[model samples]
Target: MKALFVAGTGTDLGKTHVACALLAAARSRGLTVEAFKPVVSGFDPHAPDDSDPARLARALGRPEAWAEVSPRRYRAPLAPNLAARLEGDTLRMDDLVADCRDWLSTRDVELALIEGAGGVMSPMTDEATNLDLMAALGLPVLLVAGSYLGTASHLLTALEVVRARGLTIAAIVVSENLDAPDLDQTLALLRAFEQQAPILSAPRAATWDADALVDTLLA
Candidate 1:
């Protein structure tokens, strides 16, 4: 199946937003899509719908078991590994990979989008990070970043590291952040620095140019 991993430079940096947009766009184009948050922290059992996986479920329109969307969940709003440890539970990279692969391998899923929990370097398990999981899955990454200050440094750093591992960066989506710099300048800087992958701007509270963004990836 055609798949993309929505990876962020850091947490809450618009991974889910981009993924949801793409999911909606792809569905509009008559393609079957499935998404997985896989391992999520900061889960509140009381408000189950207030979580990332639920957002994904809403976008996909497949309301079934939450575990199918997110196998490992922790209540503490911390890194998955730390949260898992606090509950005396372990998160194995093998298990994480298996869950995502199973979702991708489903025959009816024409496209799969796996959303990462934290930044690329964030630990998913005590021994492995999001990067390791990406490497294991070997899916093209649609790296997500924010248009806030210091984003250039973080985006460039993430781009370099993902490239260093010989992984294909499908594209970079710079989501608008509160108190961000000039959006045009940020996009220009990113394009000048990295010509290989297209950079798509995701403005906050504005209509997204979903057509171009989805077409680029589906290309």
Candidate 2:
């Protein structure tokens, strides 16, 4: 499966937004796309349409598959580990890897986008962080970051850790912060430090296009 794990610098950094954008772009190119958010927190079963998995499902044109897209869900708006603990359960890295493998093989999914919860350092379980999961999955990473003040420090720190784990960064997407849309400045700062790999922008626009990002991914 041609898969890319979408991870964020921190929570609410637009991982799902970029993933959905990529999914839309891939679909527009006539590729069969599928998404998996595996572990989701801050989930309300009654209002499932507003969650990350729901957005991804809608992007993939499979709105009904939202539940399947994110199986380990918790009601509390906490980290996955904390949320799972509240339900008297635990998240196993092995189980996660196995489930992902199953999802990838279940269909002829041309492009599989797996989105990680929270930041790379966010705990998925007592013993595993998102970084460990990314390493285990061995897929290219699409690191999503914000365009807010102090974003440079946060984003660079995330990049250092991800690279230290020997993970291939497919791209770094600087998501436009609505409160402070310093997108161009963020891109410029990121470019100054990051000489290699593709660093793109996710401007908050109604007509936001993902064609260029998709082109880089397909290349």
Candidate 3:
């Protein structure tokens, strides 16, 4: 029941990409792996192609059903709490934690990757945030960030918050952003926190060895 929560510095920061890479690596080693995105916004169950849950389902070799991967979904492409409100629904922090625990109890896998919606501090419910959920789960975090101009600031701010909450950070994966500066510069900017945790880079549109990333994470 080894689990890690894939959290991002901001929306679309390659959290799913990293999660899928880890899932693929785990599967290659013949390890049973499961992925969950307990809450998602801007998801259409009927159209799984553009949704995070579908991507996770495909990575895990499971059917692309929204209900299977993400228990709660809202069609509005906004924060979970706001999206839920738009759909005339409400999300309770306790219920969200309960659902996650229930799902984890049913899975017997070598690794389980739970992805949070939006950024780490994004509101999941009216009274709670993704950070609260991560604290409740009590699992190590795999923080994902983009290699954009302001990424260094965002990453450092996230690191500070994560540290303040006393959460274990398994690693930090900086996904190359095409609009950002060169990889070397971005890496250099992040090097300041190298002593904090293992910092890795994910090339954009390049062939990657998922197993290598997995090895680093497990190490």
Candidate 4:
């Protein structure tokens, strides 16, 4: 299966937005797609509408996938490791990686997307981080960043980290942030790293074209 791991510079930077767009685009082209976010914090099973997994499921036209998409969920609205500890549970790195592998093994699809919680260095367990998980997965990364202030620094820092770890980057997407200054400048800054990977820009969610975005991602 062709897989892409969606990671962001920080939390709420539209990782899900990009992942859902890719799923929608793939489905539009009649390509079977599946998405997973192995560990999710701030998830409420009762109020599924407010959860990222649910949003991804809705985008994929599979409401039932919400549960399967995020098997390790905590309601504390904190980092996965901290939240798991608060809930009297433990997040073992090996177990988390095994769960992802098990899920992938069961799927037969053209594209499988794995969305990470928080930023690349966010801790999944006390001993391992999302970056470690990404390396373990051994898939190209679709790095997501916001066009907000200081984004240039954050984006470059993330790029350095990804490179230091020797992970392949499929692309870098700058998700529009309404509170941000001129995005043209942000795009220009990202373009400087084109040699690292393709850099793409995305409009707000309301006006985003999944097909077009997918075309860029695949390119």
Candidate 5:
């Protein structure tokens, strides 16, 4: 399966939202696609179901098999390695890679959307960061940037970092977070960048039309 890692400039930048849109888009267009958010942290013990994987499962209409998609989950509202360490669990890179392979083997998926946690530099383990993991996977990245006032600089910075690391960028998605309705400036900046890849806008989470999202990503 061809895997696409959806990374972001920072946390809560609609990485999962974009990922689900990609998954639903591909699936709706008759492409066999699966979503995976490997090694998620920041789980509330009292509310066990509020994890990234769980949210993804609900978004993609695969609520029954949430565990099958994402196996490594941890409590503590921190990075995976730190959170895992707190829960007496060791987060190993090899194990995560193996789990990803195993999950992909089940289906002849056209695209595997691997959504990384936090920014590219966020640590998943003591030894490696999320960017390291993405590089190891050898997949083209789709950088998701939140469309706020300072999004242009954020996108450029993120693009430079990814380019410096020699990561292949498949595309850039500018997602509108918060409650802002004015996207003219953000949209114009993205257009001004004139990056090789396409830059698409994702409106507010609740108003996001999944069908349009799918069409654009797959188109």
Candidate 6:
């Protein structure tokens, strides 16, 4: 499987946006794609029953059982470990890895895009983090970042950690999240990163053209 983990410098950094873009792009190119959000911490209190795994299933036109794609979910809107602690639940890294391997075994897809919860350093369990999970999966990383101030510092720090772990960096996608009015600065930053990293940029809104981004990745 040509798999990659889509992670970010921090939470809400458009990791899902990038993952979905990659999936759509690969599928368009005749590659079967599957997505898994290993753990989602936050849930809508109003719906109470909502799971991000369900949304992912819908994106891929999969069945409701696809909610099983995620190994864990917590009611609190916090890091997985903390959330689990709040609910008096225990988390084990071994179980998390086991669930991921099981999902990989059963899924019939050419490429799997595993989306991490929160930042790369965020704790998935008391003794493990999302970075550890990525290392366990042993796939290259496609880092998703935003174009705000300190983006370079944030991305560089993340790159340092990823490199220290000896993980392959497939590419970096710098999104200009639509919530911001700054565009020129973001473009300049993107250009700067391309000098060293395989940097791609899109507008915060409709910032991606699936074909182009996928082509860049494959290139």
Pairs that clash in candidate 4 = none
- Top TM-score model: 2
In the range 1-219, model 2's lDDT, one tens digit per residue, is: 578999999999888889888898889889999899889999999999998889999899888989988988999999888888898988888898888878777867788888999999999888889999999888999989899988889988998999999999998898899887467877888899987779999986746799999888878
The lDDT of each candidate is 0.87, 0.88, 0.87, 0.87, 0.77, 0.76
By lDDT, the better pick of 5 and 6 is: 5
TM-score of 1: 0.95
Q: Indicate whether candidate 1 or candidate 2 has the larger lDDT.
A: 2
Span of ten consecutive residues with least summed lDDT in model 4: 205-214
Q: TM-score per candidate, in order?
A: 0.95, 0.96, 0.95, 0.95, 0.88, 0.87
Per-residue lDDT tens digits for candidate 5, residues 62-118, read: 876567657777777798899899889998888777766676567576777888889
lDDT of 2 at 171: 87
Model 4 segments beyond 4 Å from truth? none
Per-residue lDDT, model 5, residue 83, is 89
Of 3 and 6, the candidate ranking higher by TM-score: 3
Q: Clash number for every model?
A: 0, 0, 0, 0, 1, 0
Q: Of models 2 and 5, which has the larger lDDT?
A: 2
lDDT of 3 by residue, 66-166 (tens): 47899798999998999999999999999999988999999999899899998989999988999999999988999999998999889999988887898
Off by over 4 Å in 3: none
Scored by lDDT, the top model is: 2
